[model samples]
Target: MNKASTARVTLDPENWDEFRSLAHQMIDDTVDYLQNVSSRPAWRPMPAEVRNSFSEPVPHSGVGAAAAYADFRERILPYPNGSIHPRFWGWVQGTGTPLAMMAEMLASAMNPHMAGFNQAPALVEKQVVRWVAELMGYPADASGLLVSGGTMANILGLAVARHARCGFDIRQDGLQGAGKRPKLLVYGSSETHTWVFKGLEFMGLGRAAFRSVPVNVDYTINLALLGEMLQRDKEAGHLPICIIGTAGTVNTGATDDLESLAAIAREHNTWFHVDGAFGAWLRISEKLKSLVAGMEQADSIGLDLHKWVYLPFECACVLVRDAELHRAAFASTVSYLAMADRGVMAGGIPFANLGIDLTRNFKALKVWMQFKAHGIGHIARVIEQNVDDVQYLVDYIRKSKEMELLAPAPLNIACFRYIRSGMPDDALDRLNNEILLRIQEQGIATPSGTTVDGKFAIRVANTNHRSRREDFDALLEAVIRFGREVEMK
Candidate 1:
């Protein structure tokens, strides 16, 4: 046989020792980055040259591992979105733990295809799902699966709810089969995340399917109005299929009366779904758990471990109270993917039967490792501390004459605005917007902006376990300083 004919190509490095050395260096660099994250700015804009570097043509031949790692360290590592920073409170993002980072690396190295079959990864995912269900106070028999994030989790939950409660065979007849019958409707407050509407659209239910109930002064769904809408819609030949209760609204962290919503859902015989996202972790906190009182009563709950549980991105779970119904919504039978009673093809949970996506990564590893390492009690304390820090900021905002509280800080988020006593609403909006930009640009602290009750608000959503009262104090100081500076300019 010709030697040339026998040659094989492999992506593995020819020199394992050199590769190991590079890997060690990469790990050290990551540790250093996390260790000293507090010394760096919460966020920094990427320079034009660095941004332009990404536009380079894709390499047909690989840059050696060390060289590629150098590029990542120089260009990508330094310019994160700042969620990991101690002072970064923007957008309900979590500051991930170093342990989770290690778990991520381990998971990637194994690269398990988590769609199911007899495998330890499959069992790990099942255990993680069980833990999440227990954490959220759901039944031990609840069925769930981890997804990319809150959006996918929520979509899955709603998908199950729609299938189980739509009063027709959604799987077989599709939405069109409802033809000329009462239009199915999902009820939620105006404060519900835009993802719900997107989910409806994706499910072939138009945006009209979502009935937006008005929010009360506290930014929660008004129960009376919700009931009225349900009755009115019913009388008008509309079928209410689901009632979405927000465990925590994105803007203000306002929790709807979930128990009441559950009761209402029961009374109406509609599926009750809760978008817990970051707020479901509040169940772990003794001091704040009461805020999410009725959350467990939800027929389905969508939540994120990445947000409050401090895992890395792309980790969220959707739990359905009825295990069979959950599987029935998404299960598919294919000859090529048939299960077996033994060997590599059998006995483990088939995650593919629970939700969309056949090709899934080992997202459960990081979650399992994080929970095992830190313990839920420790995580709960961190969550409580975050809420306490936000309350401290709220108190500071209340005391400051130049600042106005735009919304109630019920859990871990506070929405407030910098105010000049007589400044018009429009002008104040512009000024606060400028202030927000300046704060981000100046690398002070990153608090996102949102509108509350028609007023622009600097929204501080504290999911960061790294944040402290001092960080929030610093944030307020920068806000006032920028507010005055912007007004003058």
Candidate 2:
């Protein structure tokens, strides 16, 4: 047998003791960072030298775990986009919890493919879906699956809409191959997040396939106009495949009249989808549940657990009313993946049939642990506090003679800008833009930008549970200081 070969190979560490020590140290470092993160700057730009360090070519030989860990600690971990920081208020980001972090470690160790078949992880995922449906006031048997994020969730919802509404088998015939078909159309408000548009493109429907209906000053879609548009589309021989309502718009966090939209959808025999990415969690809040009143009526909903649910990055769910349609859109058959009546392959719901991705990680663990570790009441209270934090900003802005609100704050977003007497609109826009950049560069706060009623406004979104009222005070003070300094220059 050729002497059975003298050499041996394995990817495990050479010294288990050393590896264990390093892992413990890294864990401690991460905990320390999370514990004291609020004391640090909201963000800091990477220095040129540190940035250049990443430009090096990949190494042919693997570095020891210790060295790789050191590189991550010294370089990558410190220079993230800063969403984990309490004052990092850019783009409705979530701040993770230590409990979720521990759950993540266990998941990584097991490393199971969660894309269905009978296993504990898959079972956990199915249970999580049911829990989410119940939390959101949907039917107990509502079919759903966890996805990467809001974007993929939206894509899944639209793909189902296409299969269910297009009046043909879209899986095999394809959109183009369906001859003389009604030109597939989607409708959403102008203030809806861009992910809806991206979803249309992903479904092989061009941007022209969607119609952007106008929204009122609060950024909610005008229902009267939406009804008119639906009627007009039908009269014009265009197929209105779906009407997407935003539970909380990106610019101002305004919720559309969901019940009215649902009524219109039924009247027109069209699919109604809700982009409730962050706002879907509002269903958990007894005080705020009315804000998303008609969300449960949606044929499909795209909601992100990574946002208001406070899970780590990238955890979204797509819930569909019609289980068969959801499965029909993405399910595939392969001899190797054929269903078995018993054993590990016997679970009825193959998650691979529910949505995209044949291989998925254990995402439901973090979500389930997060919910169990902190009850719904606790999460609702955190979301309520975030809304209060933004209300604090609104009061501060109103008190300041130089600042004004550009849009109403219905949820947790505040859109406002600084003003100076006799300043032209163009100059004011430039000044506010500069002030935003200065705030980010100075690491004071990380509120992003958006246009409100054609005016450039600072869009501060308080989605972090770690945020306090004092953080809003600091952000307002920094804005005034930067506005004046740039004006003087």
Candidate 3:
């Protein structure tokens, strides 16, 4: 048994007053942290001694929950990867919502196992699927499931596509042993998440199996290049298998030309999959829905509620057009599980047999609660504000002599870099790296770097809802100041 479980068994949850008091203190502390987040440093400069303290050996005598709680408050919360801070314009991680935290507490209390229909947890999973399908404008007949986030969802979606094309017997036998490896081809922009490569590897499709397409000036996928690649692949006797389009890219927030990509996939009679891990929320905003145009045409779509919907930890949704293929890919005959007809659920679809995960957690409760507590319009406005904030940064970066745009603002991500005046190309690269390292050491902001067209650039992704015009202003000022300091040195 795990240490927490063994400790819990000995202490038991029955010491009601103490545990309740502890929980209240923890909640209050978190609320305070969120309220005062703007004042805290975006990141910490942990000393080597402080870092080594965490590596201390475990004690034979157990510490009480109260002590552990105090340690968490003192040590852990302060040093979190700093995703919640407003000036943290690094990667695409999302901030957690307070309403979702309450849902997490409630879900933990119930501890639902969302594998089969006999359990209440299974019903929770079913409801989540219905919510996702309805949100995406899919028919009530769709099938879906919550996973550990976009990577798993992509993997699951590819598994479903493979099974649907190959049939259920392939699951009984193996992929190569059953027949020739279907001349599978997947397409996405060069900016697509690395998770797609991982998904391909897990599915027995080597990394080289994918065809990376080019991007246009706005950083969106170049549909012309994609069409050319597909046509060439077909002419070369290569089997075109699937098209993976990006709904929101991880780098500069570039969306693939989903409308054109879908049309191309349709012409080739290939499976269309949209990786909308963070960007699909645009569907809620009529103004931004055009960014993900043609997403509805996807045979399967992957979305991350944790990113856009502001749920805690990792919760991803994988939706498929055909419900039968979902069950055919992942279902097993377990005597302990209830066997119901595919479409026989009462209010909506039951999602138990939709994917590979069986003993899933009640992750949907937090997302459901957050959606109900905060209307879709409110969240859409938050996203719109983030986009505006990024645009503000874009304007500031354009005005700065030291900074130049690597890619234009698309959605909420802007890629730019600090350029040294009169410095050689290689020297400018070193200067930019030095500024980034200096800015990180200062701990006022946390921005990351990426290569754009073979040049090192800083990526400012405005995903946190708390980010405002002032936050962007501060970040721009910091970048300019750091660039000056690095150049002077």
Sort by TM-score, best first: 1, 2, 3
Give each prediction's root-mean-square deviation over alpha carbons.
1.5, 1.6, 4.1
Model 3 TM-score relative to the real fold = 0.91
Model 1 gets an lDDT of: 0.90
What is the lDDT, from 0 to 100, of the residue 68 in candidate 1? 89
- In the range 138-191, model 1's lDDT, one tens digit per residue, is 999999999999999999999998899877676577567667567889999999
Q: Quote the positional error of residue 364 for candidate 3 in Å.
A: 0.9
User: What would the per-residue lDDT of candidate 2 be over residues 1-489, giving only the tens digit for each residue?
Assistant: 477566788988889999899999989998999999988888999998899998778788988898998899899887889888888888788888888988889999999887787789998999999999888878988899999998899889988998889876565776677676678889989887888778788888889988899988778999988888888888888899999999888778999999999999999999999999999889998888999999999999999988898888879999998888888888878888888889878874478888878888899999999998898899999998888888888888888899999899888999899999989877888899999999998888899998888889889987898887788888888888887888544
Answer with 1 or 3, whichever has the higher TM-score. Answer: 1
Ten-residue segment with the worst summed lDDT in candidate 2?
A: 167-176
Local distance difference test, per candidate?
Answer: 0.90, 0.88, 0.79
Local accuracy of candidate 3 as per-residue lDDT tens digits, 306-389: 787767788889999888878777766666454665533332224556776666778988877787788888989988888888
Which residue pairs come into collision in candidate 3? none
Better of 2 and 3 by TM-score: 2
Q: List TM-score per model, in order.
A: 0.97, 0.97, 0.91
Clashes of each: 0, 0, 0
